[model samples]
Target: MSWDPYATLGLGRTATADDIRRAYRKLAKELHPDVRPGDKAAEERFKRATAAFNLLSDPALKSRYDRGEIDADGNERMAFGGGGPRPRQSARAGAGAGGFGGGPQGGPAGGADAFDLGDIFSDLFGPGFSGGGRGYGRMRGRDIRFTLDIDFLDAVNGAKRRVSLAEGRTLDVAIPAGVESGQVLRLKNQGGPGVQGGPSGDALVELNVRPHAFFRREGQDIHMDLNISLTEAVEGGRVQAPTPSGPVSLSIPAGSNTGKVLRLKGKGVGGQGDQFVRLLVMLPEVPDEELKRFVKKWPKRDQAPPRPS
Candidate 1:
């Protein structure tokens, strides 16, 4: 007796298509050949999982197996070989019965009757059994590749997102902290279905971090531009800057220029890198009449430039 595909996969006879898919995915993840390369035990488990998936994935084959018309290993039942129902005969004496038990002359039971085991096998297990009893052989499912776009903040802070596949399956993927663009996340056993009891493939997710308008990443460091008023730039003051963690106060030096950068230590993604804030000093727009009057009497510096004659 061949191994029961359903039993090998740990699925019931009434398992639905979705149930079969879920089981295959779970098993493939646990028994992927590449993941456990050089390990004989894992390889055997992978083979068994693949076989179960192949048998259950096909509607015709699954139906036949469920009806007991085919063996668990996908071989045709012995009773089907005689062609329909045979005349009742004692099991012990039937082996020696001559001429297919008194059939018409030169009929299906006569000397001219030739039984092609290949034809019977083909009818039972589809055409082309080149692999002997190894069952159907075909390409496994294609490996799936897709990109997941995550917010910069989320990438730094970690987040959970739901991803949908073309097969109408949605999976919840957790984005780890400090993940960068072009990073690949492998979800084992989420790829295409295998054929002939072969293992399914995998789903590979490429991470793409969306750029933030205000925050930028430099290695593990976080960079941001801080807008400061003329008074704050000239007088040097404490300003609030945004970091991956949250808003934090940063000190600005007196006479700070438009391009001066200040670093806040250990305020970045993993709290191991620094946060850099570049100052952008904004001058006040043309003053109104009341402000212009006050500025007209403001102190002015007297200076002279030396020119070579």
Candidate 2:
């Protein structure tokens, strides 16, 4: 898709170089791939945003684009009279070796289209006797790859970022939500220049998401550990638990044990995965003298013993 550079950068046609740089930097911080890695949508936006910025960042290119010589996507428009601004000649030169009456080959008078074709071929290949040779060599630019690392929360919520190229150029990337690792983002014609007027290659950005301390992702679900005291587990009460959205209250059933799992629905990334709270019973390292005495004097008369069949 053709994107308007000025509109993408939030600037006018008359914006200065300094203004463009500042705007790019500001948007880059929020949309860079490093800030929202593993997000496919965000990566696509980043590519488009950077492509727009790259086209507008160069003064000469921007001028040419503004003058209607090229489109926003950097495609040269066909000028008037066919290829360029050059003028065409009349049909006399194209006639079959004679005047309008007749030709040496006994054919009708050649039209302007024949003359134009001859002119184009003569300009391109230097007046060949006949058509037996191919024209132009193939030249392709090198492909560029960018690796971006994003924070866990930013990957989930989406963010913007800036990436600095080897040539000292910076790109503004917009990261979208719900991206995954190893996703490739392609920016067409944004790579190295062609050797002999051939089209440029592309820039590819790969995504990498950072790990979260509290949240462990399983597919789309998020898992977390919830610590509950012995009293709360025995009495069954509402306890606050940590989730990606924030802390939420969870009901602990009476007589709950360690390793018990409580599920909180729609609390994961994109609100599609369930948040599992794995209960961990934390025991005090040191016990008081009274507690020790009570534990020592506890009755076990009703306790049942294991029987083997």
Candidate 3:
């Protein structure tokens, strides 16, 4: 359809190489096969965006395209600018040693092997066409996609996973440790077969890391609120704290207060981080008269109350 590359990538002709790259990356993220699986329209746009970015990212090729020396596909345009078909001229001007004004069997003016038309054609239509006529005979296979959701701990700790394909076939998948939401894992040659002996497309697994019931993430650290009785906050004791790996006994310092962050080293995802436990001192539903009396008459209790952290 003679689509302009800039238009395909949603950019102007004046866009710099970096601008083009940024535009492509943004579009690719939104339209990746794994992101919008089964959406053929988005897939087509994604491919076009990729191709346009590739063409515009090369300085020589982009300059040639801007000068009308080449088309968006990096092919020399059939008609130069607005002029008619330009005659192929000699590389050294006039004619070669073997020919002059047509002669020596009308040998190409420059050298014996003047130009490589095959290379030009190949460049124009991707590396698919090799001969005189243009063709996409061996088409690449269509990529298949699947959404895989794993538990938060499993995702953080890494686990052997499996997925059931559309055909009801189960395949084992390796879940990488510390994998984040929206991450894509590629499965080679697990998609649709290629046409005319082309290589098969890949299987794209879009991973979703489920949120933990009590745990939250910050960088590599895991955070959760550790609830303890008000008495425990005043008296030091060990309490059971949940880690992604399992429940572990965590020591609470005497006089521990609410919003206190306690660290457990090497307890976070993949053992690369520490687990931060935020202490939440819970008051007894049944009020303690002695504790209430003590708090009410505690002389130095509130010269200044601690501010919220």
Candidate 4:
């Protein structure tokens, strides 16, 4: 494709360096391979945007490009003098098979111009390519980020999950126990592939723990409300209670009212915290005729609970 650094970065010739940077960052965040795995079109756009950024980020390169001294690929344009555009002078007199940006073959000089591809690469890849070095330089790959939604139990108990990547690839990620929402798990060497022999980047996975139906967590403690019949609350007996691990037996105290809390040690997050079970005394949905009649005649029924002062 015809590379236009300004257009690729969604900018114009009048755009400032800061403007260019902002545009590139916005596009990279939206078009990065990790954001939309296996989307070729976005990946291509990402690569183009990166290339454009590299070119435009460097002041010298940006100036040269703006002046039409070099093309989008960093190859020098036809050598133009004060008079007008002119062909680059070939080193070989007869061999006109010039390298990049050289005159066409069989031109003034039969041989191609001795252009150093390494020099061009050194300008683009940033440092380490100089000192008369040849071939592509090494550059570290870009870091990738992803969001992984997991069940609340899985966050409390360490679990393994597979993360999907581009090209039908998968990465196994280990979620630590007691991981909270917004926590990031980093996998080294799991991002975009490096350029040449450079090292690959890391993969950052942010956790999004899904909410439970009735259970809530505070710090390391677990809290839930357990409904109990009026008989069980007044008589005080053992009843089944729900926990993250499983159902457990709970003892209710006599005359227990609503908002009574029961603590189960070592039954919370990671089996190290505590579970607070609040008792909710509930009456039958329908009124019982026999109970209603008995209450009306009972003398103690007139004794109401003391109200707050």
The residue ranges of model 2 lying beyond 4 angstroms of the native Cα positions read 1-141, 194-200, 300-309
lDDT of 1 by residue, 1-309 (tens): 246677777888888877876676676556654446678777667655654565566665566668754444333332110113222121111111111111000111112222222333344445864224433133243344556677889889888888665335776778788899878787776655444334555566677787899988888899888999878987998877788888878888999988888888998887868888889988667756865666677665234345598
Which candidate number has the best TM-score? 4
> By the lDDT metric, which is better: model 3 or model 4?
4
Taken over the whole model, the C-alpha lDDT of each candidate is 0.60, 0.56, 0.61, 0.64
Collision pairs in model 3: none
Cα lDDT for residue 9, model 4? Answer: 87
Candidate 4, residue 213: CA error in Å? 0.4
Off by over 4 Å in 4: 1-119, 122-136
Tens digits of per-residue lDDT for model 3, 40-119: 78866765664465456656556656886544543333211111233222111111111111101110112322323233
| lDDT of candidate 2 at residue 58, scale 0 to 100 | 54
The residue-level lDDT of candidate 2 at 135 comes to 15
Among these predictions, the greatest lDDT belongs to 4
Clash number for model 1? 2
Per-prediction TM-score to the true structure, in the order listed: 0.52, 0.50, 0.55, 0.60
Clashing pairs in 1: 50-197, 51-197
